[model samples]
Target chain A: MRTLKFLLQKEFKQIFRSKSIIFSIVFAPIIQLILMPLAANYEVKNIYVAFVDHDHSSYSQKLINRVYSSIYFKAAPYSASYDDAMHLIEQNKADIIVEIPQGFEDNLVRESHDKLYLAVNAINGTKAGVGSGYLGSIIRDFNQDIQLQWKQPGHFAEAQTIDVVTNNWYNPYMSYFLFMVPGLMVSLLTGIGAFSASLNIVREKEIGTIEQINVTPIRKYHFLLGKLIPYWCLGMIVFTIGMLVSRLIYGIVPVGSIPLLYGFLAVYLLTLLGAGLLISTYSDTQQQAVSVAFFFVLIFNFISGIFTPIDSMPEWAKVLAYISPISHFAQVMRMVVLKGSGWSDVLPHLGAVFALGVVLNTWAVLNYRKTT
Target chain B: MAAITLDNIVKTYGEKDQKVLAVDQASFAVEEGEMFGLIGPDGAGKTTIFRILTTLLLPDSGTASVAGYDTAADYTQIRNCVGYMPGRFSLYQDLTVEENLKFFATIFNTTIEENYHLIKDIYVQIEPFKDRRAGKLSGGMKQKLALCCALIHKPTVLFLDEPTTGVDVVSRVEFWDMLKRLKAQGITILVSTPYMDEAVLCDRIALIQSGKILSVDTPANTVKKYPTKLYAAKASDMHQLLKDIRSYPGVASCFTFGESLHFTFRQDDAQNIAGLKATLDSGNYLDLVINEIQPNIEDYFIQISEPVHA
Candidate 1:
């Protein structure tokens, strides 16, 4: 314990002494936390749309009003010809085009049927897909209204009585920042924790100071802990800063316990910092450690569903995602903070994280042999 | 009683075809409170031997002990008592000199204050620049700082591998002065240097070549071991003097020694300097001057060593 205290003191001093390391540890995450959530918005809006109307009827006008009124789209001026509307798509000014037939209202009135055409820009396929889906839903709602208005009072038919209502839980407005900021916090913490711990030993390796340390009476576990605990402390600080920023700037206060979030974080940082030390143990140089760390960090972030939902991934990928440490933390972060889940709800994930921490830190300590 | 003992320690690295026997059946012992040197050039396994003694590298066979503790089994005890300064400068370069010393001191569960008297002679020289980063210091200052850190723990046994390899002559002298003072403190110091002149400073040295000890004796004893009478000869044509004297059938061995050639005679040849001068004078050499002089450690090392495999 005495040895570890001195080692930790030296580590903290070195970490705080370097201008670049100080920047990376304390300030970099805060800046990323503040900016990344704002920039990484997933909700697509203001999709440009142009209309080609052959029908000047009130039905076509109502459809135009509905399309213009929805926040998902912006209405472009009516094109004089189909060629002009096609020009909007060619120039990238329009994301979608709607064409109504000349007798769209008459056809709906007399024949009770009409055909409409939609030309969607397939570029940026997510925007195209969601835009067309939203437009389809609006036209469907319009059709239902017309059918109800056309029904006479005497000819009413019996219908099913079940009323279906959907509620988006936790995030009623589907605010992307609330869901994204917590996960981003996990990513930045892992990057800083693992990279710093891995590079710390390897930096000593490069500078040749590890040889001096290796010859000392300090135990391997003491050395590993000494090298790791500083980064773990830094990881916690970054995590706290992220949580506060989430609450203050983004209004993303956790509904669950803050202490519980920190508790899982302690275990999670150990797992990450242990993995980093393991990399340092095998690597002879700092460059090797960093590259290997980069490789793992990339894979861990991807499988943890930083950009995609893990549930939507293929079966094998979802299985792989379950073993990823961050996924467990992300689960806890989203569940506890977003859903106000208690200890019983996060118990399984905490257990898995604790087990991973034990196994990984054990492997790291074992691999770090004092005698070569 | 010996403070360190290496008994037939052999260490090899790599696989079948690429194997290298880094330390080969090396055996030696340093008496308590003695100054011992492992004198050899790079790749002569000096660093390897130091690593083994410091409990940082295991020998492939045999056993070694430091301060009466078995390196393999009682390494904890050995590590606590020994201070190791590696072949490379191993202090944190980003840290200041004082910080580096304090850190090493703290690791041994001691403070710089506890051992100030031990390292004062060397630390005082570098203490003026205590805030300077270790990497930014001159080679000599860095050497002093490394020695200070190694000494800060007040170790019973000090292992310095190539401590003066890149140091300036003045710092090298200063460093040896510090080591002498440390030896006076009853610390058994084992220092290694490739330079032959540094060998004379040790109480005893193991002359190693190619991972094998060629000779182990006091500096004077090794020089006295030079079998035949040796002469330092010079000629106006110094270049031709070497080649011509070497080809003289009576010459046993010939090598350039500091602006002159030192050579001895074959077993059945004339031992007189006059006769040898006659032979060299006949060879197209100029202004031949021969002086019978004592051999130094470098001359002794050169004449005594043979290729290990041979």
Candidate 2:
């Protein structure tokens, strides 16, 4: 225990002395918290669209008015030909284009059938898919209006009784920032904890200070725990600052107990610190540690659903996400903040992260050599 | 009494085909309270031996003990009772000098004040920079601080591996002086250095090469055992003088030292100063001079390292 205390003190002194570490620890969370929420919105709005209308009749004009009425699309100048609309899409001036045939209005009125062509850029496949769905809904509403106008001359229509209700469970307004910011916070904290801890140890090795410590009577486990504890505490502090910023900037507060949120965060930080220890044990230089940490954090963040919903991912990818601690912690953070979940709701995530922390820490301790 | 003992200690890294014999089957012992030195060049396995004795590494096949405790079986006890300063300056550089000293002391379950006398001679030199970050310290000051940290616990035995490699001449003198003071306290010290001059400072020295002990004895005894007639000869054209001496029939060994060619000859050779002068004069050598010279530790080492004939 005394050995651990000394190691911890030494590590803390090193981290606090460096200006870069101070900046990364105290200011990174605030900056990320303020900027990420604004930039990382998932809601797609004001989609620019163009129309290639060959039909120049009043019926075609009604169809154009229906597209313009919905807030989803902002219609650009009408294209004289399909080539013009294609040019607009290629130049990124518009995201979607609609083409109406030469006899579309006459065909719809006389033959009672016409097909409309919708061309969507699928580079950002999610937004393109959503935009297409919104366009289809608007066209359906216009078709129903035409049907109602044609059938109600002087005939009495039968009235049917129907009840409809809707409820958005966790997020009533479906604000993407509220859901995404908490998860992004977890990712940032993990990156900071793991990278900094590993870099500290590896830096000592590179500079030859590790040789001085290796000769000391301090036990291996004590030395490792010493390095781990400081970063663990730092991780928690960053996590708290992230929460405060979420509340202040985005007006999002934890619906569950704050203590419960912190408790899970503590275990998750241990997992990250343990991961740092494991990297430090294997790497011989600070550069190697930094690069390896970059790879791990990158893959972990991508699969943790920080940028996309896990449910939207393929089944195999979802299975991979189950093994990621970030995925588990992010889910727990969202559940507690957004859903007001209790122990029963978060128990599974806590179990996985704790178990991962124990295993990784054991490996780190075992691999660490006192003599080399 | 033996404070530390190694019985045919061997350490081989890697497997069969690719194995490197870092420390071959070597054995030696240090008497209690004696300053033992291992002198060798780099890659001669000086560090491997220190690591094994410090219990940071285990020998593949041998029995060793430190202060009467088995190195493998009683490692924790051995660790607690020994002080080790590795080849590199491996300390928490981010910590201040005072904090680093305090930290090492705490690791041993002791306080710096409790063992002040042990490190007082070295620590006092750098105490003014107590609050300065260790990384920002000068090489000499850093060495002093490292020595202080190693000695804080006042262990029964101390291991220092190349403690003065990159240090300046002044600090090297001061460091050896501190070591002599520590030895007066009846603590067994084992230090390794590639600097042959330091061999004289140790009570006894072991000359090692290629992971093998070549010779181990007091410095005086090792030099006295050198069994060759050595001479230093030079000329205005010293390079040509060396070539001429090597071609002489009775010359045993010839190598150029600073401004002279140090040569050895068979004691029973008929060649005298006149014969050598005749050879150099015939070769058109200028300002020819020759003098009998006493051998130092380096000469003794060179003599022993030369391949023997059947």
Candidate 3:
């Protein structure tokens, strides 16, 4: 116990003395919270639009005005030719192009309907889909107005249609910040837990201080535990700061008990710190440890449902997410903050993280040797 | 009583086909409270043996004990009773001098104040900069700080593995003086160094090479064991003189030492020196001078390490 205390004190002194830890703990969370939401929004607004209106009658002009007035589209007037519209789209100056034939007004008045072509760029598949939906809604509304002006108002009332209402349960507005802040918190904690903790041990190895400790009477387990606990505490402190920033900056607060959120975070931090210990045990140099930790954190963040919904991923990918502690923790974070979940709601996730933490920490302790 | 004992210790690294016998089947013992030295060049397995005794590494096959505790089973007890300063300066660089000292003391379930006298003479010199980080300190200061940390617990035995390998001459001298003081306190000390001059400081020394103990005895006795007459000869052209002496009929071993060539003959024939001089004279060697000198530990090591003839 005394040896453990000494080791812990030494570790704390080393971490606290460096200004880099202060920067990572305080400033990194702020930067991630402020910048990530702005950069990751999926809703497309102010899309530049162009058109080839061969029918330059009042009817085509009115239709063009309607598209220009909507918030989602901006009309960029160009030559009334398909080649010009194609050139605009190719240059990335326009997102969508509409082409109306020469006899559109006469055909629409005489035959009651006319075909129009809408060309959309499908590179960003989701944004293109949403844009196409917006254009279809606008054309449908215009056709309804034309019918109401020409025919009886009750003519459309007889037409049957399915009315589906979607009630978004937890984030009604679907704010991207609400979805992102908690996951960013998980990522931030991972950075501190894995990078800092592993660097601590590897630094000792590089500078030859590990040899000094090896010759001491301190037990291997005690030494490792002492090294891990301080970093675990730092991880918790960073998590709290992340939570506070989430509440203050994004108005996103945990709907569950704060203590419950911290409880899971503590377990998650242990799993990460254990991972750092395992890396340090295997690596002989600081650079190697950093690279290995970076690889794990990168893979974890990508597959852990941090930026994308896990349900949208394929079944095999989802199965892989089950093994990632970050995936489970990120799920718990969203559940507690957005869903008001209780302990029972997170017990399964907590169990997996706990099991992983125990297994990894035990392996780290076993592999850690006093001698080379 | 033996402060340290090893019965046929053997340590090998790597697999059988590419194995390196770091410490071969070697055995020796250091008496209680004696200053014992393991003198050898690099890769001679001096550090390997020190590591095995300190309980940092396990020997593949051996029954060794330090301060009367088995290295394998009683490793914890052995660790508690020994102070080890490894070959490199392994103290925490970011921590302050005082913090490093306090940390090491706390590890042994003791306090710095509890054993202040043990390290006072050494620690007092660096006490002024106790708040400064160890990384910024001079090499000598770092050496003193490491020594203090190792001795903070006042272990029964101290293992210093090449502690003065890279320090300045003044610091090295001071370190040896500090070691002598610790020895007076009845602490059994085991130190390893490649410097043959430091061999004289040990009460007894073991000359090791290629993981094998060549000779173990007092420095005086080891040097006195040189069984042939040694002569230091130099000419105006010393390099040419060395070659000329090697081809002489009765010369047994001829190696250059500093500004002179040290040679021994197969027979201690009085006429051999005159005959060698005549041979050198005929070879156009000028200003030839020869003097009989006593052999040092290095000469003794060279003589033993040489391949023996049947």
TM-score for chain B of each model, two decimals:
0.96, 0.95, 0.97
Runs in model 1 lying further than 4 Å from the true structure: A50-58, A75-93, A145-165, B131-133, B233-237, B246-253, B264-268, B271-292, B306-310
Q: Candidate 1: lDDT of B296?
A: 90
| Comparing 1 and 2 on lDDT, the stronger one | 1
The positional error of residue B184 in candidate 1, measured at the CA in angstroms, is 2.4
By TM-score rank, best first, the candidates go 3, 2, 1
lDDT of each: 0.87, 0.85, 0.88
What's the TM-score of each model vs. the native? Answer: 0.92, 0.93, 0.95
Off by over 4 Å in 3: A158-161, B15-17, B308-310
Q: lDDT of candidate 3 vs native?
A: 0.88
- lDDT (10s digit) by residue, model 1, range A31-84: 999999878877789998898889999999999999889999998766967789
Which candidate, 1 or 2, has the higher DockQ? 1
In the range B1-310, model 1's lDDT, one tens digit per residue, is 7899999999998999999989889999999999999998789899999999998889999899899999999998988889888978888888899899989888888999988999887887888999999989998998888888888888999999998887888878888988898999999999999999999999999999878878889999999998777888888898888887777777778887778888887663455556667777678765778887888988777776733323
Per-residue accuracy of model 3 over B41-124 as CA lDDT, tens digit each: 999999999889988789999889999999888988888899998888888888899989998888788899999999999989
Q: Which candidate is the best by DockQ?
A: 1
lDDT string for model 2 (B148-216, tens) is: 888888899999999999999988998999999999999999999999899999999999888889899
So what's the TM-score on candidate 3? 0.95
Model 2: what TM-score? 0.93
Tell me model 1's lDDT, rounded to 2 decimals. Answer: 0.87
